[model samples]
Target: MRQIPTLAPLPARLPDSVPFVGPETLERQRGAPFAARLGANENGFGPSPRAIAAMQAEAGEVWKYGDPTNHDLRAAIAAHCGVTPAHVVVGEGIDTLLGLAVRLMVAQGDRVVSSEGGYPTFDFHVTGFGGELLRVPYRDDRQDPQALVARAVEIGARMVYLCNPDNPMGGWHPPEVIEAALAALPDDILLILDEAYAEFAPALPRIDPDDPRVLRMRTFSKAHGMAGARIGWAIGAPVMIRAFDRVRNHFGVNRIAQAGALAALADTAHLDRTVAQVAAARDRIAAIARDNGLTTLPSATNFVAVDCGGDGDFARAVLTALGDRGVFVRMPWVAPQNRCIRVSCGPAGALDAFAEALPHALAMARQGASGG
Candidate 1:
């Protein structure tokens, strides 16, 4: 018998699992399309018209690869954020940039810190790079910045991950708290601040790009309503920004995405409108949850997390019942956090579907538990 090639130790040790199962996969599993697409925290408002136009204009030039340096987009992002171009590094999306950031900082067996139930993608990146993750639990449904810093210091962590207007719980810390946490962190450790949902939140005081201890990641995938476009940028000290280039895919960002991101950055009006719509949708979701005897966590992102009034298993049943009704949504992956199911902001039709299905879904879950 012929011997097969052996896998690398790191890859071999990992489980065959993805951080998220896309709705498309769920559709396949269910053998039917979901009636409401409100689970992935995507902007249902869609991309700005200006961005659509820009992508269309560039459609004919698909043959040309995007600028390897991502020059124009980086310049536009810098201007928008009041930072210099040297402070920006463009990538396919925050996910890719996160992977890059982790690779740049983590060595095998190096310790990292994050919330117990923080953004799974960041945790996935850390584990893939063989970094030991120390997860600090959320206090009162929000990431405990103080706990994170303490854990980082205790473990001598090389990196710490945070998400503002965080996913799953849709909670955030005040700017002062974030700044204090940053100040408390050890100089040797880098804080990877994922602000992918920043546009929907109140304007927070900016962290100085001169600070080498932090890397701020932002994206057009949220308030700009361009998740499919796959464009995100990182802001950091000039030296740290340049370091991403050493490991990033040279042509990772495509021509159309670059064009769309540039146009989206310039269209502040569309962004404002999208933010307003998301806010309205969030209110509608909260109202619906309240009417059904559930409660919603305050959200600064384009989604709301509805408390199912029970434990993780109860929320999981509710989530499952919603899926059976062709309404797709998600819940947190860990204990207390998993007591809520997340619903993304979307067009009126999508929310309407959610509103219609939720009561029946909850009823079904309760009935199932009561042996009805």
Candidate 2:
């Protein structure tokens, strides 16, 4: 037998599960296409026409590698956020940037703090870097910032992750609450504020880009409708932004994504239209849930979490039933919150498909729960 090199101690010990299973993977397993793709919280509305044109123009130039510095996109993002380019670092997406941020700050056995059922990718990165993740459970479906800060201080944690207008359950904290959390966090503790859904948020915490204690992440995946493009940026102190150059994949962001994102950023009208459409779709989803005698949690993101009026097992059944009917949706992995299924905002036709299937899915789920 041929000899193979041994894996590193860190990777060797890590779990073999991915943070999220893509809808494409599920479709492949089912051997059928989903009629209503409303699971991933993606902006099915899509990017601006200008953005499409820009990517199309860049298509023929895929032979060249993207700019290692990501100069133009960084400058544009800085202007948009009213910060200097020195305070910005662009990357493939928030996920990759998060991994880099984890690698930059966390070492083996370092203590990190996050919500119990918060964004799993952050937890995934923390564990990959051999950090100890201390979770504080959600209070009333919202991420308890105070609890997170308290736990971080108690553990002498090196990092804290908080997702504003949180995922799996789209609830948000106003500016004051987030400001209080930041004020409470110790200066030595780094706060990785994942604001991936910031565009749809009502009000955001006023954190200065110069604040060394916090690194704010924003993505083009949601409102910008460019999840497939895989581009996002982080705002931090100049020193922190410069540090990413040490370990980041210089050419990881492809040329087409860069062009598309740049064009998308410039089309303010299109972004405004997308946000409006998402808000309307959220209302429609809530209405659909109500019509089926279910309720939905308040949402400030591109998705709504519809309460299944049952436990995690029941919610899982509903999700599976929806999948069976060619309606793709998802649910939280942990308890309490898992009682709800997440449905993303999409075109009217897609929502119609979902609205049509949901009642039947629920009926099937209820039958299964009763062992019928």
Candidate 3:
């Protein structure tokens, strides 16, 4: 046999697993299409009509590479965020941008901090870069910012990651709390704030695009309903933003995605409608949980975490039963929080399917728990 080149020392030790398994992969494994897809926290309400029109219009132009500079989109984002283009860097998605950020700051064995069971993608990036990832536990279902900062300081961590209006738990801290966390953090420690669900949040902390200590990441995937488009941006001080150009995949963002995101940004009416629909869906999800004698955690995101009144295994059993019934939903991976199942907001019909399947799924899970 021909000899093959050995993998790099860092990558050779890492597991061959992705941060998340896509719903498509799950469907392939299950050998059936799900009747409802609410597990991914995707905006099932879909992208704005204007965005769709723009993408369709740009389809013929797929022959050309997207602007290597991402100039026009960055300009639009800068105007929207009240920052100059130099302070913004566009990338394939927050996931790619997270990887770039990690590469920029995390040296081998350097300490980085994030909440236990927080956004796993960030963790993946940190580990991939051979950085030492230190995790702080969530307090009261929200990321304990104080604990995160304290741990980072204690270890002299190079970076800290926090997700606002958090995922898989759907809790949020007030603006003051976030600002206080920023104030308490040392200037040397870079904070990576993943604001993927920012659009659905009721309130947000004011952004200082000139702040060197923080990088705020936002995505078109959630609120813009452009998950498939795979576009996002990060805002930081001009110096930090400029550094990304050295390592980022310059032509990675597709032309269609750029066109779609640009149009979506301009269509404020569509965004407002989607936000309203998400709020209504959140309330409906809570009602469904109540009807099943379970409870939902308060959410400022487009998803709700419903307490299954059991432990991780029980919630997992419920999740399996839901999957068996062609309803796709997810639960937290770690305990205490794992007692809840996460349901993404969608149109009425999808929620109806979930509402229809839940009671039976709970019955099956209970029966399995009883060893029947």
Candidate 4:
């Protein structure tokens, strides 16, 4: 096929890669649906009934574009967070906001730092904008902010990314630890603190709304069960927050999502119930892991990482076995971390499905062990 005249030659620098493989794609490839959909860290307990009712009530508004100012939602978020509306910027999701942040801050050949085998989405955005990566290995499975900052200073990095309650591993540092990390960064290096799981973490620290050196990211996807809503925002200094307006898609947040997030925010009782359910699910996951002679990693988020007591290959075998039998858990991508399989907190029925498949997966893992 001839290249189109209107399009320039594709950049040689960007490697072909996707940040994550969706569970739906796996179901398609396996020609079967997952009995237990616990791989993606989504809240399967579901969104609040109130949020759904609100979305339904607002369904007629779909014909109109979302408010360009996002007035009411922004105001409510500001009130909840104890910050002015100027300090908030909502987007399609943290993923989209991350892309905008990377594009705004990283110049060609600029340096970015994150934990090795950390959330790949941030790394993807960095490279998509021509920034070189400086990946520091995680310290004891938790992404170490101190190490990240040292590397950032070493490389004169333009940006650093972190997930408070990190993905895959589901580990986290308290807010004070985060405060210390903020204090450690050079003034010019921007820290994109992704707090997608903040709502589920019990040890979450309080931050003064006036903090200058950090941008605390939050999303409704986890505890609020709004993964489909695609509502995420950042809390930052007014000037920093305003910078997003220069590049963000102003009308990217849809009307249904807006109603859902606002109602979800107002339903704290439902949020508490969901958190309790997640805790119970985590306990069940731990129990299952222990029964199977697997080790479960400590988690502050809504997922657990069960050590398969072997290497990446063994864990992959276990994951495949589970998927074949209709369970859909996942594993980390790099060794050491990849030695375990990650499972999200789902409905009790889903947990039962995982419990049923795990022993068989373990047996398959052992059978394949010699091949490794």
Clashes of 3: 0
Candidates 3 and 4 compared by lDDT, better number: 3
Estimate, for each residue in 267-289, the C-alpha lDDT of model 4 and write its tens digit: 99999999999999999999999
Q: Candidate 4: misplaced stretches above 4 Å?
A: 6-12
Superposing all C-alpha atoms, what RMSD in Å does each candidate have to the true structure?
0.9, 0.8, 0.8, 1.5
Worst lDDT run of 10 residues, candidate 4, spans 4-13
TM-score of 4: 0.96
290-368, model 1: which lDDT tens digit per residue?
A: 9999999999899999999988988999999999888999999998999999999999999999999999989988987
**lDDT of the structure predicted as candidate 2:** 0.95
List residue ranges in candidate 1 displaced over 4 A.
none
Best candidate (score: lDDT) = 2
Candidate 1: C-alpha RMSD to true structure equals 0.9
TM-score of each: 0.98, 0.99, 0.99, 0.96
Location of the lowest summed lDDT over 10 successive residues in candidate 2: 2-11
Model 2: pairs clashing at backbone N, Cα or C within 3 Å: none
lDDT of 3 at 363: 98
Worst 10 residues of 3 by lDDT: 200-209
Across 271-290, the per-residue lDDT of candidate 2 in tens digits comes to 99999999999999999999
lDDT by candidate, in order shown? 0.91, 0.95, 0.94, 0.88
